[model samples]
Target chain A: DVKVTQSSRYLVKRTGEKVFLECVQDMDHENMFWYRQDPGLGLRLIYFSYDVKMKEKGDIPEGYSVSREKKERFSLILESASTNQTSMYLCASSSVKGGYKEQYFGPGTRLTVT
Target chain B: SQQGEEDPQALSIQEGENATMNCSYKTSINNLQWYRQNSGRGLVHLILIRSNEREKHSGRLRVTLDTSKKSSSLLITASRAADTASYFCATFIIQGAQKLVFGQGTRLTINP
Candidate 1:
């Protein structure tokens, strides 16, 4: 079974503080992604990593950065957390071995910036 | 970027009734997928229909993709109370690299 776990289910941070969200996948998937879900905006991709040490900016990557130093783990970084950055952060992984298939997601981290 | 737009932002129906949700995309896609997310939880992939395929099914879930019109529909038969969740339609763009664009999602409430 494919399992993805996030570091925290709920997190709170003050404005201008640095925040780090971690995600780990049991399966050796090559693709990992970070997304933020909001009320009416839906899910917006923040960043994606296809391989270790490689990253790509997604639609809403302005205040967020990502790191994939290891194959099994990915991290999302917020240099200066702000009130607007508070949202439900989700992590996902996909494998390219069989073909282009659906992505498996983690339980998600609800971050609140006060 | 958001490519798909789901119709009827919210739906309320009784259990045992069939629920249908529609999604329309703006560009060419390689495939369309349906995902369900429970309250404050991550999304679970339900079904994926390739651009060439018109329809596919799994359990009580049925998905249809219309490449020409860039539209898709998800039909859940005999809905159960546990089926209450948000349904999102994601599209794999032809030019997108292993990334899928998601819609705003439809909130489904099943009343028993």
Candidate 2:
């Protein structure tokens, strides 16, 4: 079975504070993604990494950035946390073998920016 | 922007009844996938249907895709209370490098 684990299940940060959310996958997948889920917006992609030290911006990449220094780890960074940035952050990973393969997701981190 | 939109944003049904959710997309897709998320948890991959395929099933879940209308439907037969969750349909567009665009999802409730 594939396992994706997030660094924190819940987090709280003050305004303008820096925040980091980490994700690790054991399946050795080549593709990793970061997304923020809101009530009406669903899962909007923030950033994704296809390989080590490689990143791509998703639809809603503003106010957020990501890092993929190693194969198993992906980190999402918030330069200045704001109340509007509070949401359920999800991490997912998928293998690149298939054209369109299933993505395994980690238990989301509910971030509260106050 | 979201490429898919699910209909009947919320649904309620008794146990043993079937639950159906519809998703419609705006663009061509290489494949469409369905995911289930329990409250406060991440999504679980349920099923995937390619653009060339019309329907596929796994255990109690049935998925149908219509490329002409750019729509898909997921049916859960004999839904149990444990089946209660949010169902989201995501499209894998070819433009991006296997990036998935997801819909708002339909929240399902099954009463015992």
Candidate 3:
């Protein structure tokens, strides 16, 4: 079974504070993704990494950055968090072998930017 | 913009009844996948149907895809209360690196 783990299940940060959400996968998957879920918006992609040191911006990448220094770890960074940034952040990883690979997800981190 | 849109944003059904949800996508897709998320939890991959396939089933779940209409439907037979969750349809676009574009999702409630 594949396992994806996040650093925190819940987090609170003041406005303008820097925040980091970490995700690690044990399946050695080549693709990793970051998404934010909001009511009526579904899950919007923030960023994704296809390989180590390779990153791509998804539909909504504003105010967010990503790091993929290693294959197993992906990190989402908010340079200066704002109240509008509060959301349920999700991380997912998938292998590159299949045409339509299933993405395994980590328990989301609910971030509250106050 | 979201690539897929789920119809009947919310649904309620009693146990032992079948529930169906529909999803429509705007662009060409390599494949369509279904995911379920319980309240406050991460999504679980339910099923996937490629563009060339019309229907697939696993356990009590059935998925149908219509490429001509760019639509798909998920049917849960004999839904149990545990089936209550938000169901999302995600598409693997024909152009991208297999990144999934997700729909807003349909909230399903199963009454016991």
Candidate 4:
């Protein structure tokens, strides 16, 4: 079975602070994504990485950045955390080599920006 | 903007009853998928149906897609309490690495 792991399950940060969320996958997938979930708004993509050192912006990428220095790890960075940024963060990974590749997700991290 | 929209934002049913949810997309898609999230946690993939296919099933779940209308429906037969969760439909576009666009989601509550 494929497994995706997140660095933290819950986090709290003060406003204007820097925050980092990490994700790692053991399946060696080529596609990795970051998403935020909010009530009524559904899930919005923040950023995605297709390969090492490659990144792409999704629907809502403002105030967020991503790093993919290695194939197994992806990091989401919040340069200046704000109260509006408090939400559930999810990480997913997928492979491009197969038919109808499904994404595997991590448990998610609930962040509270004070 | 969201590419897909799910109707009946919330649903309630008793055990052993059938539950159906509808999703409509704005653009052409290569495939559509169903996922379940429990209490704002990570999403678990349930099923995926390609554009060429009309219907697909796994276990007690059935999915149908209509390309002409650009809509899809998911049916859970004899739903159990364990099936209670938030359901989302995601559309996979044909271009740009096939990024998935998700819908607003439907909250399903099943009573025992």
What is each predicted model's overall lDDT from 0 to 1?
Answer: 0.94, 0.94, 0.95, 0.94
True contacts kept of each: 0.81, 0.88, 0.78, 0.75
A80 Cα displacement, candidate 4 (Å): 1.1
- Per residue, candidate 1 scores C-alpha lDDT tens digits across A24-56 of 999999999999999999999999988999999
How far residue B81's Cα lies from its native spot in candidate 2, in Å, is 0.3
TM-scores vs. true structure, each candidate:
0.97, 0.97, 0.98, 0.97
Best by DockQ: 2
- Which 10 successive residues of model 3 chain B have the least lDDT summed? B92-101
RMSD of 2: 1.1
- What digit string (tens of lDDT, one per residue) describes model 4 on residues B35-107? 9998857999999999999999999999999999999999999999999999999999876656888899999
Interface RMSD of each: 0.7, 0.5, 0.6, 1.2
- Which residue pairs collide in model 3, if any? none
DockQ of each: 0.87, 0.91, 0.87, 0.77
Model 3, B38-99: lDDT tens digits are: 99999999999998999999999999999999999999999999999999999998775556
**Candidate 3, residues A1-114: lDDT per residue as tens digits?**
999999999999999999999999999899999999999999999999999999999989999999999999999999999999999999999998965577999999999999
